[model samples]
Each structure stands twice: as C-alpha cells, then as structure tokens.
Target: MKIRDKILSGILLVLIGVLLGMILMFFRQGTFSFDLAEVKVTEVNRSESPIWTDDELEKIDDRFVFKTIAKTVTPSVVYIETLINARDRREMSPGEEEDGGNFWDRYLPRTRTVGSGVIITADGYILTNNHVIESAVRDGINVTLDDKRTFDARVVGRDPSTDLAVLKIDAENLQNAVIGNSDRLEVGEWVLAIGNPFRLRSTVTAGIVSALSREVQIIDDLRRIESFIQTDAAINRGNSGGALVNTSGELIGINTAIATQTGSYQGYGFAVPSNLALKIARDIIEFGEVKRGLLGVTIESVTASTARRAGLNEISGVLIIDTVEDGAAAKAGVQSSDIILKVNGVAVSESNQLQEKVAMFRPDDQVTLTIWRDREELETDVVLEEMQPIVQETQTIPENNFDEEQLGPEPEMWEEIPGDENSGIEQQSFRELGFSIRALATPEDPDRFNLYLHRVQRGSEAWNRGLREGGEITEINGNRVHTLDEVEKEITDSLKNHRSLTFKIRTGQGTDGYYQLF
Candidate 1:
C-alpha cells in the first residue's frame, strides 16, 4: 500500500509541472484566434467611344499647329552625351579661353557634356554642333532617341569653321527632319526650337524670327563663318546642335548659341541656317571635310562714315580692306578700298552677308561681284580658289622674355589729350586698349625684332575684337611693325588723331585675322 501511494504522488507532481509551464507560455504570448478573413471586391463601369466631332478633326488652330509640330519633330530630335578626356577638355564657349584653375583641375580624369542632335537621314545620319562632340573620347558618344533607345554614334566629319558636325549610328528607319530653304525665311515668321534642354528631353519652344545674318563674334576660329539667324526663342546650354523648325515642321536652322549674362535663356538665341548647315553636312559626308571656297578678300561693313569717305552714292555694300596676293580676287583686277555692292546679283550690305553668299559655292566656282570703284559700279568675275589650311606650330614664349624698360613707347608719349565735351568727343587712352606688345627675337635673325602680342586682357575691347595673346603683330595701321616702338608710335598717332587702328595679326593658331580698334 505504501509503495503504491509514493508512485501516485510522483505522477501527480509531474502532471502539475507540465500544466504550469503551459500556463506560463500562454500568459507570455497574450492571446490566439483561429479565424479566416474574407475579401469582397466590386467592379466599376468601363466603355469605349468611337464618336468624333468635325470641329476637333478639321479646325486648325495655333494650338493644333504646335501640337502637330511637336508630334512630327520631336522624334527627329535626339539627346547626345559625350565623354571628353582631360587632355581634350575645352571650355564650353570657344571664344572664351580657360585661364584660371587649380593645377589638379586641369588633369581631371574625364568630363561629360550633354547636347542635342537632329536626325538628317533615314539610316541614322545625325547633324550636331562641332563643339558638341569635337574632342570626345573614342567610342564615348551615346545618342538616345525619343523612344528611349540608345546607340553608340561615330563622327562622320567635322567643320569647325561652321561649327557643324555629322554623326552616324547603326540604327535604321529613323525619323528624319525635312529641311527647308533658309533663304526664304523672313523676320516675324513663327518658328519652333526643339531640343533636350537641361536634360528635359524633347522640349519644344515657340518664337518668331528676330533677325538674320547676325555676326556675334562667338566663333573662335579665324576662318569661322558666322551668319546666324537670330531669334527670341528660349535656348539653353544643352540646346546646342538642336533643330530650329518652322511652323510647318520644316527644319530651317540649327540652334547654336544664346546671348546670356547669367548662362541661361534671356530672350536671345542664334542658329546656323539650314542652307549652310546642309551644305557643310553634304561636304563633310562626301569629302570628309568642308570644301570651302575662298574669296581671297578681307572685307568689313561699309558704314555711313566709310560710305562718306569713299564717296559712295549710298551706304549699301561691304568695304574691301585688302585682297589676297595672287589670289582669285587679285587676278580678277580686284583692289583694296573697293566696295562690293552685290554678289551674284544678291545685295550684301554686311560683311556676314557677303561671307554667307560666298560660302555657298565650292572651289573653282565663279562668282560675279558688283564692285563700286571711283564712284562707279563695275561687274567682275572672280573664280573662287581652294582654301589652303593654315598650319600653326604651338609657340611657347619664355617666361620673363619681355623687358618692360626696352619695349613700348615712353609713358610721356601717351599723355591724356583732352577732348571737347561739347563736340561729343570722349578722351581715349592707349593703355586702356587691353593689349600690349613685345619684340620677339628669332634664331634666324636675332637683330630683326618681330612684334608679338604680350598679353590681352579678357573681356576687354581688344579681346572682344578678336585679339588674343601670343599673336604676331605684322602690321599696325597698314605699316609693318618690326619693333614694339613702331607699334606704340602707330597706336599713339591713331589715338591722338581719333582714328581707327587696323591691325594685321597672325593669330596664335597661325590664321590671319584683321582687327580694327576705334
């Protein structure tokens, strides 16, 4: 009986312990339920419409025109992204040189620039600005279409003179823009600017043609041809190489630049005419280079003063300042101080107009120039010559080569000459001209001193007039300057006489550019 009671008590203790553990676990976990929740969903009404209104289908309004242009032209525009290596990196503005920066910044590994391009061929021939992809690395250009497809692009050719370049891709059946004649485009006509501005893809803006044949002096190349179509369209940095089309969705120009002080759109925009762009594109694709015809004459605008001085009946031509020796113009009996009244029967009042007209032809092509000489108009046939490339050797001037004491005229020679305030003549100083010269010594003839520009202050009058550092000054005021003294003397005499000073300069790039200072 006693053994049976002990076994029963141990069994009871084990059962109680197990029950206590279960209770503790239930208390820690709080509560539990066995429930299955059900979901209930209801359907909404949906339908399709096939009805159309005659007003919506036939009535064409300004909004309809813009919508049609956007739908037709947006697909033709593309986004271009380029990877430029450090060695080939250049400033965004060609006319502006990179002057100040940390040494390490110059050696950055890589940089990227974004712009836009227009498809010009069904097989993926794209037209863009030279500055857009000029120095990109090999296999670094990526073009994105409106459909979000991206492809690698290859450069077909580039023309720095016109700031135009052609690109090729592997894609086919691309949407291409229909090019229209820019010559027929007139001021006050409605136009559209299409581009990927500020990374906003396929942006379209509307404006009117503000002006024509404008020379803004933005191109840095001495042979640069800048006869841009000016407009009030809003264009930003990334809009370079984009398409400027008419209301009919015809491509009429290539958006190139903007006149902005804050680096954003402020009303003014410029474009390369489609006529010139198409010509350059065709040449680049056919010959791998722009076969530009050279007229062999340096010309300027015939202003009222110039017309009065030359005894012209009207101010309606370009003044021929000089002619290339043995060139086509010289061979055709063209002389300095003559006025070019018309080119091939087209009246040209500005130098840019003449340049644009002549740039349309090829080498060996003949052009008739209506020239005014000795108060009479005479027609002369000038066969355009093949343009010869200007080869320039990068010249490095030795530090401290200029001796301030030995070069330039005495300070007393440039005394401030007071001008009559009543006559509206303002006193001008030679020192404020923004440039200085020094005598360069050559190994061939150490005794023969050659005048070279020492420094040209940026944003100064001289710089804006296309004077740059390291340029060789061959002549000043039509007089050959072998020494800095001659340059100083010529400049002093001109400043004192209140006359314009003409400088014949061989630029650092070894191209000849005539600069005039008032």
Candidate 2:
C-alpha cells in the first residue's frame, strides 16, 4: 500500500507541470499575433506614401500640357467659309436637244467651300491658304471664331505663288496666335494642329515635326514657291489654313496641305513655315501685294549625271541651266553651268531651296551667292530685281496704201463659200488652227487696220495657250502681218512644215505677249 501511494503522488506532479506549460504557450502565441498586426499596419502606411512630389507630378502630366496648349491656341484658330460662282453652262444649239433638254440652263450655281484660318493680329487679321479663297465671291466670305462670333471677312491680299492669303475682319480684341521661329524647330519636337477639319470646330490633333524644308509641288502656279514643313499630323480638306503650333502654344507653321492618296489624312501633312508665312502676311498688309525678288537664272537640282559631269564628289547644290539676258544673275556675272552652293550664307542643296531663299528678299536686296565654278569656289554679290511678267513687243504694220476692192471681194463673201470650193479649203485650213479673225478699221483713224481674234475653238492649241477672243495678232513668225490673207498664208505654211508657229499678240488691255502654236 505504501508503494502505490508514492507512484500516484508522482503522476499528480507530472499533470500540474503539463497544464502550466500549456498556459504559457497560449500567452506567447497571443503576443506574437499582436506584433504581426503592428508590422502589417506599418507596411500599409509605407505603400500609401506619395510616389511623386507636387512639382514632379505637374511636370509629368502630359494631359495638362496638351490641354493648356489647346486652350491657349484654339481661340486664335477660326473657321472660314467661301462661296465660288460656277461657270454658266453653254447654250445648246438647235438640234442639240440630245443633252436631256437642260439646254440654256442659265442659272448660275454657287459652290461652298470650308476651311480654317489663324488670327495674326489683335485688330482681326487672319492668315489662310490662297486656294481656300481663290475665286471667292466678294460678299460670300465669313469667319467664325471660337466664341461663336461670326463676321464678314475681306481679303487683304493674296499671293498665289506662295499659296497664302491675308484677310481682315471688322472686329476688335481678337485672339492672335504668337508666331514662333520655325528655324529653331527641331525634328521630333511635339506639335499641335488646330483647325476645323471636316467642319468640325475646335479640333486639335497632336504630332511631331517629321521634316523641314520639304518641297512638294502642291501649288499649280507657274512661279510656285514651296518650302514646307512636313509632319505626321492628321490634316484633312478643311484643315488647310489652320495653325500648326508648338508645345509652347506658339504658331510654327500654317497647315497648308496633306500628302495622301485618299482625300483625307494618310499620316503625312504639310505646312508653310511660320517665318515665310509671317513674311508674306506682313508684306501683304503693308504693300497690298507680295514683292518677290527674282534671281533671273533658270536653275535645276544637282543630279548624279550633272554632278559627274561637273566633277563633283557628291550630288549637291543647284545647277544653273541658263541665265536670262540683263537679269540680276547676268549682271552679277553668273553664267550657265555654275553651281550655286549657298545664298546669303545659307547652304542650298536644291533648286527650290535657292528659289525660296532668294524670294524672301526685296527687289533691291543685295545677296551674296557662293558658287562653284571650274573647281573653284567664288562669291558674287547679286542685286535682286523685280520679277516681271513676260512681255512681248507689239509689231505694228504700216497701213496698206492699196485699195480694199483690189485685195479681194467683200469680206462677207469669204464666209458664204461652199464646202467644195477653193475658198472653203482656205477657211477649213484656217479653222484647223483653232481661231477666227476679222480686220477692224477705226472710223477715227481710217488708215489704221487691226486683225482681231473673234473666236477661239474650245480645246484648241490656241485656246489652251491662253489665247482669247478680242486679242489682236501683232506679228507671226517675227513678221508683221496686216491682212488676214497674210496671216492665213503664214499659218498654213507653218502647218505644212510641221513647225511650231509663234504669234506676238496684244491683249485688250494693251499687254503685249507671245503664244506658240504647234
């Protein structure tokens, strides 16, 4: 009995020890759970900390940048509407009722065109493309501003060579765009195109400057001047005359055209550089016309063949094909085969670049030209001249002292001959030249006889060459012809020889000019 009691006491002690250990473990586990909760709270606080400072945040906000530019520049962009009168349809002749009975539809139709423009002055001077307002009716032009204010705009002036026009609106306190230096613009710099594209007002598109000094023959003028800035901006039909601004909301260019196969934007857009646009605008505002300087030298871009012939290491500079007589270049001793390397210290690689550079000057501006001739670099100072329209001298022939009755029968008899007659052969041959003439004698000056063109056949070479009714033929093949017989004989002989005939003619306004018929 004494041994069993000793074993039972030992078992009771072991149970007390086991219960105490369990209580200690439970308390320790509770403390560990409290510590873990504190660690999680600290981690959450760190993660919630601001990733960017206030200044940094503002700097990185591209939306804010674009929005600020749009807001500042959009007000300067205006929408333009132009109305053009359509030509009258020809009256149908008798038995020509085959034109669906719409003959003699004397109703004139007016065509409406939409475009964009940029305000350049506080007194409401706007700049746009000349093509946007070409042939626009005087009272049919209107401008709509951002504030929904509409005003009738008058054309200040237009320069077809540069495809630019200036307009004046009768308003005050207009929002004007700040002109920026396009020469300072770098490729890949961000830009914004603001305009009314497809008549959608206040449209803004973002892009980058893709190129500079791009030459695209978008203008059809004979003396076209193009030095365009190329971009990837979205430009459409109505975007012409819009503003192309930089990130600072300064106008760098005037959106002019887009290179696209479709009528809409296809990733390539063009603009007139701000410098050139501003120059043209200022000139028109001050002078009512663009006074373009002329170099009087026909130039071509340097090609591989030309470079090789000139012994050039690389195809660069402009090759002078010919120098006009008594022109600025001729006076400056510039000759054909001379390679123009630079104008006024600016390197020129193409003919258009040189032309544009020269055009920026005034008529009397003295420009220094660096030329490469005979493996030597030579510099010449050329004083620019005003570009004049090609004018020919009217060759006046002395009145015939012979009597009219001895020359031929009555003039009306020539018009009444049958198709099989000899006179008909002469008439048919004359008609093949695509014009008819009549001799006009002035009652006040009876001895003065003039041959005036009364008709020009449609689609004829004479008509295509800009000959019109009322033009007086002054000379043919360098010979003064006073009678219709002499004129017809010269034309027939030239036709038989298959040679081009040159006619010196005088316009109704007394402007003398020459035309070629082949």
Candidate 3:
C-alpha cells in the first residue's frame, strides 16, 4: 500500500509541472501576438480626381457658403502634437548603451508642442510648417484627425526656405483639401482661417485679403521665400500650418504668422499661397526634396530712387542688380540695372513676387521676362537654372576678421576688414561721411580695383539708405569710381552742393541698388 501511494504522488507532481508549463507558454504567445501584430495601414493611394465636382458644390445656397466650407475643410485639417525629449544631452553611463540608456531615462520629461496640418491627399499625405515638427524625436509625432482617430506620423521632407514640411500617416480614404488657385486671389476677397488655435481644435475665423505678395521678413533662412497673402484674420499660437480656405471650400493658403504685438491677433495674418504650397508639397512627396528653380540674378524692389535712376516712367517692376556669370539671366542677355517689368506677362513689382513666380517652375523650364532697359521694353526668353546651395567661399581673410584701419568714421564705428596679399586690398576711413572705403591696390585699373565700402556706421544716413558693408561702390552720382580718391571727391562734391549723395552699390550678394543719402 505504501509503494502504490508513492507512485500516485509522483504522477500527480509531474502532471502539475506540465500544467504550469502550458500556462506559461499560452501567456507568452498571447503577449507576443498582442505587441508585435502589424496593423493594415501602409498603403498609399494617390489620385487626381476631385473630391466634389464644381457643379455639385455650386448647388449649395450662397448663404451657406461659409458653413459648407467650414464643414468640408475641417476634416482635412488635422491637429499635430510633437514630443521633443529633453534628455537628448543626457550621457549614458557604463553598460547602459546596450538598451539605449537607464530604464528611468525612458520616462524622462518631454517637451510637447502643438500645431496644425492639412491633408493634401486621400492616402494621408499632410502638409504643414517646418517649424511645427522640426525637432521632433523618432516616432514622437502624433496626429489627431477630426474624427478623433490618432496615428503616428512620419516626416516626408522639409523646405526651410518656404517654412513648409510634409508628413505622412498610416491612413487611407482621408478627406483632403481642395486646392484652389492662389494667384487669382484678390484683395478684399472673403476667406477663412481654419486651425487649432491655443489648443482649441477646428477654430474658424473670417477675414478679407488685405494685401498680396507681402514680404514681412518673418522667415529666418537666408534663402527664404516670402510672398505671403496678408489678411485681417485672427491667427494666433497653434494656428500655424492651418488651412486658409476661400468661400468655395477651396484651399487658398496655409496660415503661417500674425503681425501681433501682444502675442495675439492685431488685425494681421499671413499665409503661404496655395499655388506655391501645392508645388512644394508635391515636390517633397515625389522627390523627397524641394527643387526650386533659380533666375540666377540678385534682384531688388524698384523704389522711386531706383526707378528714376533706371529712367523708368513709373515706380514699378523688380530691378536686376547683378547677374551671375553664365546664369540664366546672363545667358538671356538680362543686364545689370535692367528692370524686370513682367514675368510671363504678369507684372512683378517686388523681389519676393518674382521669386514666387520663378519658384513655380522647375530647372530647365523656359520663362519670358519683359525687361526695361535704356527706357525701352524688351522681352527675352530665359531658361531657369537650378538653385545653387549656399557655400562658404574660401578666402585669405575671414569675413569677420577686422583690421584697425577698416573701422568706420567718427561718430559711428563698424567691424573691420582684414587685408590680404591675395586680394591686394587697401582701405581708407572717411570720418566726415560716417563710413570707411576699401579698394584693390591697382586703383588706376578699373577692372582690377573697383571701390568697395568697407564699413558703414549703424544708424548713419548712408546705412539707412541701404549702403551696407562689403558693398562694391560701382558708381557714385552716375559716374563709375575706380579709385578711393575719386569716391571721396564725389562724396565731397555732393556734400558741398548740399545734395543727397546718390550711390550705386553692388552688394556682396550680387544685388545692385541705387541709394540716396543726405
């Protein structure tokens, strides 16, 4: 009886061990399936079909335009939240690199910022501002749709010059914005700014287009393109990258910035026009980059002084200051001081406007430029060139390295310019003029030693008139100056006559402008 009892006990113990092993295996397999399962969200659907026919949209009552536009656009504009980890600078200790860091670091504090985005396609391609998700960490972007569904977002591409970025989510059949022609937007037209303002989602504000092609100088990049549509819409924080729709429920712009003094709306808002935004978005989606075409010339707005100097009858068009060697404009016979009256027959009065027009095209695309030179209008066909990336030119003297003699005049002082044998540079400071002058040592040779403005005092009359440092003094009072003495004599003569000094300055950026200083 004792041996039989021992055998039964051993069988029972083995059965209990087998039961425990099965339970453990079941739980492990359940956890793996729950955590590692793939979701069906990877397909991208790109179509050119319109969401709603014009006739179908036109059937709506005129009185319901605002409400219809709001309802249709709200679903396309999404709320974007980004998490930027604050522990980016935290160093991992010994034996911590295997799992990335200490376990506690995973729960470290994060900085969160909110913005908005517009769905440009049905497959979940989104367009927003670069500043919105510029520094977001890996897998840290969460997008909340109008229907309250959330998904992780991935960056498609970014264009800092345009302040634009593209993102993608694992979504399909999403409501997309109906893009309209922004070039046809007129001043005083009714428009709506729709976005999440101050964390308030789906906020809409009504306003009229106050201006067009406004260069507010808000973009921080040197290669920035600013031809914003200015409106009196109430755009505040968190409204960035939102949609600015027209009465026809069409997307006209992307709400970008507000001209405010108290951190709220003060009757001014700006947006990137839809035509440009759409082009940028498509480029990013197709090529993973912004392929901007270049005119290969430095241009400036044609002011009254410049118009008069260029012998123009009216203050209109953009002035070509200088042309790059072998550039599109140069190859097309576009000369310095020529006024660009129109591009493809569209009048461009500001540099930003011209930039926007050219930016709409790709490299090798030909454009017609109506130029005003010698008081006559002439048209030339220019093939747009690829924009060259900004490169730091290697020179014997660094840009900021200064010498004592290169400093400016009596009341105001400027940073210096270092001399080098390779440049054959010489400088002279004119205290009476509030600036210093520099030139090549071979002053007698016009080609070798063109006079350059080494320094100009801050707040000086010349500086205020746009006579900046590193400017080549090509001409003074309509006469070309090859030597420093000639430049001084012309200035003295102008001052003696009590006349405003007219200077033709060619800036380091290769833009030429005429400035009048008294």
Scored by TM-score, the top model is 1
Tens digit per residue, CA lDDT, model 1, 1-518: 99999999999999999999888888789764445786689999676753544347435544447778889999999999999876455444433445434456556799889999999999999999999998787899999999999999999999887899999999999999999999999999888999989989999999999999887878766567888999998899899999999977999999999999999999999999999999999998899888988888877777676789778878789888888779889999999889999999988988778989999999999999999999888999999999877532112222234453444443433444453434322232446797666665555765456666656655566765667656677877556877555777878876775555778887555666667664
For residues 264-288, what per-residue lDDT tens digits would candidate 3 score against the true structure?
Answer: 9899999999999999999999999
lDDT of each: 0.82, 0.79, 0.82
Q: Which sections of candidate 1 miss by over 4 Å?
A: 1-64, 86-109, 311-313, 392-433, 437-501, 504-518
Report how far residue 153 has shifted in candidate 2, in Å. 0.5
RMSD per model, one decimal: 12.8, 15.1, 20.6
TM-scores of the candidates in the order shown:
0.69, 0.63, 0.67
Worst window of 10 by summed lDDT in candidate 3: 392-401
Candidate 1: residue 270 lDDT (0-100): 98
Residue pairs clashing, model 3: 321-512
Clashes of each: 0, 0, 1
